[model samples]
Target: MKKIDLSKQEIEVVQEVLDHWQEQGLLEQSKVRELRENIDERGFEWKALARYAFWVALASLIFSVVSLFSDDTLVKFVERFYETPNLVFCIFFGALAAMFYVLGFRNKKKFPEKTFSNETLMLAGSFATAACIGFLGQVVDRNTNHFTILFLLSIIIYGVLSVKLQSKLIWVFTLVALGVWFATETAYHSDWGFRFWGMNYPLRFTIFGILLTVFALWGQPRISVLQPFQSTSYVVGLLYTMLALWCLSIFGNYSDFAAWTGVRQYEIFYWGLLGVILSLSLALYGMKVKDSVSRDIGFVFFLLNLYTRFVEYLWDNMNRTVFFLILAVSFWFVGRWSEKIWKKKSAY
Candidate 1:
């Protein structure tokens, strides 16, 4: 039988739905196989390969550009041209960024199925955008040594471009720029201190993440146009908050690594306690609200918090072979449980 043509995402959703139905005893194994045979998937393996290939190509392009700058002949030739004006390099990359953005937009409209190729164009734009920002930084002179100004410019440019093009890739850079701006701005004001108001980088970022999450929640209803990014904003927020919590677990507001290591791990148990409390609280809130995204984030981080504590407290104290044996057993159970819950019975 000819399969029903569907995008990879659509196919995955369909498979999940089918699996759920099967698990509920609403679908037979034979019928599931029939449905699966009907759906024309390019297969996840191919999609994964394509995605990785795109990344490899992007990395190669970046390496090539960096190698050019490192080459003596190329560096001398560039230095000789137009007296090595920073303004020229800035304009050049800025123009290239604009061109790639235009190409990405056109291809997205014309060949929507060519996802990897379209994103490659956007990736090029991002590199050029960064280059433009770097050169602009070299050209600009300010009395202050703060580089937060560059991030501010990136936020403005990338934010505007994201909105104009409705490109998630550009929006990702915008979020990153916002993070950089916060970190840099706070560090600048703090006189490069590790602790500002008794909090370190991770703690500060945790607050930022919480604030961003709240903003996403509160702003989505009021701003209809921004609804598309509601999930993106929330995910980024969760990532920042959860990762910060993990960091705080290991080293509370201890400014220096040496200082942190000098103290016993048990002394920093309070931070780990806080992490466990926060993760579980979020997970419970997610369950109560029936929000899958929040629930998944909460649950994953809850497990992560527990493991982080285990690693911090028990890793060095126990014998290496024993530690890995326990770890292996734990993961085996987790895998078995997951397979039982999510995997369907074979059709054959």
Candidate 2:
């Protein structure tokens, strides 16, 4: 019989459960022994190792290319490379992107188990595509900063490719491109001002994040092809929302550090309070709906807001030792509460 391999912690949990069942006369001792014989603790985490290896390999490849280009012998070649026409570079990178995408698609079909490798190829293709778009932008430079068009083009291209290839990696790039386009387009409309329509970057992005999250929750589920990407989109949207809110809590609507420094920390108290309230509300809603992702993010951001407030309001007035002690106690209490909740859930 094939053995089931599990992590040490998982094996321990299974053992404890089996022991409890036997003690309660729910499972036969012989049956428990048989089950135990078929289970083995995994000796290593090859999947994690493979993931790290792939990223390291990619970094090394990049470094090697950079080193080769920086060599003294390649000075003339490097200068000439820079002198090369934007259109030529654009075409070259475009071809490279096409080749990587084709290869990645072929690999996905032929060896479905090589998930990391296939995704890496797709990642390379995405980078190449971005380079191609950038060069294309340079090729059509008209002195005006119309580079926002390139980001829009990237969003369209990546969006199409993601759907066609059913690739989460490409979809992530599409979302990133969308964000870039949104930021640049807004800035352009505002004449590159620090504030757009009386809102700073953080405030503007906070609104953008809310809209993105709403779309992910309500709009994404309606599309059949997008169902697979729903969770990713939701998480990314939430991350954007939470991060922007954090920034808003710190910076409020201030466009510059100097402006922010002129106001007391209490002046931004409303923004922090808003973040805390929203996070708490989300946490409650997530718990009611049994949404783990929402619950985790909400709880984490709620704690973050509390910590930020603690520092902002009490750091100068309180002793360092007392402040750290309070933080430590709070963390310990939270951990104990979380453990109790985990136990209750496990019992159920």
Candidate 3:
């Protein structure tokens, strides 16, 4: 017999039904477990791989297109124009982006089941939007290097498009653009240096990430426009926060590696302390609020932070055999603990 695939929601509904039947004495608990075991609840791996492969293919296509212009003959031909107006390129790419977005939108509306094709169209539209923005930057004056302006423009454009189309993919671009704008705006105002309000890039981004996470949690419940994107925002915000915390653990408030290396480990240990504390705090808060996403992010990053410190501080002093042995033991313990929890849950 061929195996049938079930989505998470479908599996959940079936499980709930099984539980209801079991409660009514119509089914045995053991039978419920057996039925669930036959159904595949975690089919995310292949879907995730396919999505990644699609993006990789899209990137390769873009790279191939750019490579064509890298030919000597094509480059010289293009350089032949002393004043190649970038505005033309901007308009051209803008039109292409609009075309792709419209096509993608129409396809989504008419054939919503064609997810892969819809995503492909949206990806192409995003690339076209980037190209248009790049040319737009080139066409403008270069005196006041407010490059962040372009990022801000991208945010507005992407944000409007995302909301109008109710597209999480485009909203992701908007979030990225917002991050770029924040970094560039801070750097430009700080005279292109790392020190922003006495904080380094990672530290600043840490604060920004926390604020983003909070706003996502707070806004989604109240703002109807943002409800669809709540989960995306939460995940993205946690990623940013975790990454910044990782960087902060290594570099502290130093602007560059040279400066960080000059300082002793003990001197910058406070940053590491802060990182761990923040992770734990987030985890605890997650448990308090019953938010599994936040809790998982915190717990996972807490372990990562611990391992990072081990590698940074112990690699030079510890023996290779001892290091690997410690890692093996640690992972074994974690596995055993996880199995124990799983068994207990299964019993219940």
Candidate 4:
């Protein structure tokens, strides 16, 4: 009895399908009319507007803070406050984080429909928590360059909070903190060198990503509390791996830019080849398994690799107009192919 509010395009698609069904004698005219009557065309997309407004508000808040600090009086006030003990900052931000979390939880419980606002509060809490941790680290600083411990602490704190709150936002911060810990820990062990056991940063993260992805696929599903985070973990792990692979394709295993430039492009072709093979393999595997996330990542990165290769191989050799023309045609073909697939799926 409830009318479904849909966009204009969606309404048209439903109408077209109803018309087709009536033409084929599959649906009665009266039934088609009734279905059409239940479809309400939306005049505006308020959800999208709200999402954009929230982002704009965040940007404006940042600009406002910048503008406030640009004033000489405010600048002097902050300069005087800079002499305050790190312990004070730590306690202040820790209290702020607690307040935000409490408010976020209260709102989530009382007004569950305010999804964006609830998450925004949680995000603010996460930032405040990070600031609290950072100041705590500074308070205990021994000039040992062992501040990587703070990240480890963050991983523990954020992980506990995420599970307690069932918050994907906090879980994302937990993952980010884990990555920071891993990277910094490795760098510290290697005495801040570019290579750790002959593996550069990208290579190191590629391995880390593989391990994370494997754990998400094999381990997370078995753990009851972790199941909710499985998709986020899987997606983030793949993004890390694919992005690292892209970087490897560009820079190879070289430690520095100078070394990379000295080596011929053909010498590093193997990395690119490996990236292409993995991308294609993932795409095919995703299609077979009906994993939409994997399929999309694989396909997108496959195209990215091709475009990068096109630029690397043909940029100097081809005419500027011809290069862009080929690029445009390729994108057009891709759009047409996607449309065909969408239409076929819709027909079903």
Candidate 5:
């Protein structure tokens, strides 16, 4: 259970949090098995620091992303004006980077780290910040000096935030940043421009998928929802869908010489195959988890099927009511089935 300094609401929620922790014992077990550390044993000891760190990680990520995409005239003007080395900016950035390094560096622990609660939203914020900074570096089109300065500065500031929040998500995020760095450093020598906007790198996509999968797997020790894990599920689902799209797009026939725009016949076949396979897989998984995980996954596949049928509707533009009715009926059946499974599990 988390203790909130500000309000009774946080204190009142303690019971719910305890139930949540008990329910999520699976994750606790997994972590213990992996790290040989008793994270679950720590209980509410790290709540405040972890929570704060999580927020900073999230904020840092968001700030970095926004900074990268910022079209702000003032920002641009500042960049133009202070184009050279400035001790003031350097000092400003240096401190934050130092903090980020200290917090996120796994081995740099003041004392051997023991327990930690994962905070998905906050860690996402951290990753987003790194991404934004990376993007900004890309935009500036520099060799190393400016980006390194920014990167270092951000690492310290956000790093401290990560510690304060005790966000495991930030730790995950740091891993991702490391991976991305590895990718860029190895293939293109820290050339992010090519990777972000360059040709499709299948391996990179695969890596991204793996990362999302890790998030999803780690998030759900049990079926209950939380801010971080739910986000992971959504991301995993989205990435899986994107993977299907990317593969199909690859197989589709395109114009050899002349310009034309339309999906190929092979594309339809691939999508249909994926839809069927995913639906079947989800239904199979439904036999295990009595929660909406399988149901939601299956829904994505069903939605794809509906889309294909709707495309056929476009050609005929008739019997649209039948299509809608089929969707409604399918939704109802799935809803009932899900309720039955959940109720049965609860009764047990």
Candidate 6:
């Protein structure tokens, strides 16, 4: 019953949604009547869009496959296309969108009693479309120039769709997409990437905050393990910290510590140890206070200890006994604290 103007790239999405809706026959009787009455409003545009998506799919596959036949195709393909992976990604998405429409029609008929078969189809189609395009670009050309951008688009798209649809599966995909993007981006760049700390840190922090907010809003009364954002929080948090610490460990000098303290090595070690202790203590406090985010942050500190120890002592293995001993003591303390919290709560 609603029609909206969208970008050229969004044609596939619109077509998929409409097609899925038509297939599911999910529109209410009154809504269906209204749609028919206003058939003149969007019918032609819709048909043309579906047709265009069809042609896009047909043409893209035909060309992509045909290109495989000619020796010149891969190398000689216009530099313009190479420059526009986004556009190519979009077209590839459009094509998969077309395929999804056909598949949705079949699935719709198969599950006639289902209320949201169409919405699922639409989202699944969109994700598949984006992934397929990305895969093609990544594999065939071996040029992953805009890969981060593409992955971000997919993740953002899934996040939005999940919210709109209230579909946990969509949320799951969104989280997975973000996790993969973070890992990929981080694994590739460490010290070299830290130079852009001023710009990248704020941007990433903002994104993380926003994602956490969205996740909180979406969760409403409580956070869900089912939530796409949940599993990734630990991973992404630890990853960012690992990267940041890598920066610190590489550049942190004893002279820098000497300014603040009497003995350089001992001071640095004390400060690091203090930070780890406080971070862990805060995590325990958070867990006691029922603050999930703080607890998560605390766990990240534990992860930091693991990472710092591994990196600093990989060849030397000097902290072997100390590391394991500290680990045991920390766990014991945490366990005692947890028992206290539970006992107090149980008494209440």
- Each prediction's total of clashing residue pairs, residues at least 3 apart in sequence or on different chains, is 0, 0, 0, 0, 25, 0
Q: Specify the poorest-scoring 10-residue window by lDDT in model 6.
A: 246-255
- TM-score ranking of the models: 4, 2, 3, 1, 5, 6
Per-residue alpha-carbon lDDT of candidate 2 for residues 1-348, written as tens digits (9 for 90 to 100): 999999999999999899989988999999999999999889999998999999998899789778877898877667867878889999999999999999999999999999999999999999999999999998886587968988999999999899988899999998889888989999998899878899988888888888888988899999988888888888888888888999999999998889889999899999999999989888988999999999989999999999999999899999999999998999999999999999998774
List ranges where model 4 is wrong by over 4 Å. Answer: 23-25, 64-73
What alpha-carbon RMSD in Å does predicted model 4 have with respect to the real structure?
A: 1.8
TM-score for every candidate vs. truth? 0.82, 0.93, 0.83, 0.94, 0.46, 0.39
| Candidate scoring better on TM-score of 1 and 6 | 1
The local lDDT score (0 to 100) that residue 333 gets in candidate 1 is 86
Model 4: per-residue Cα lDDT over 68-101, one tens digit each:
7999988988899888999999999999999999
What digit string (tens of lDDT, one per residue) describes model 5 on residues 217-247? 6655554423434554445544554454444
Candidate order by decreasing lDDT: 2, 4, 3, 1, 6, 5
lDDT of 4 at 26: 100
* Candidate with best TM-score: 4
The C-alpha local distance difference test score for the whole of candidate 3 amounts to 0.86
| Candidate 6 TM-score over all chains jointly | 0.39
- Model number with the top lDDT: 2
lDDT of 2 at 71: 90
Q: Tell me the spans in candidate 6 whose CA falls farther than 4 Å from its real position.
A: 1-130, 136-144, 175-194, 197-289, 296-334
Q: Say which prediction, candidate 4 or candidate 6, comes out ahead on TM-score.
A: 4
The ten-residue window of minimal lDDT in model 4 covers 53-62
lDDT of model 2 at position 199: 91
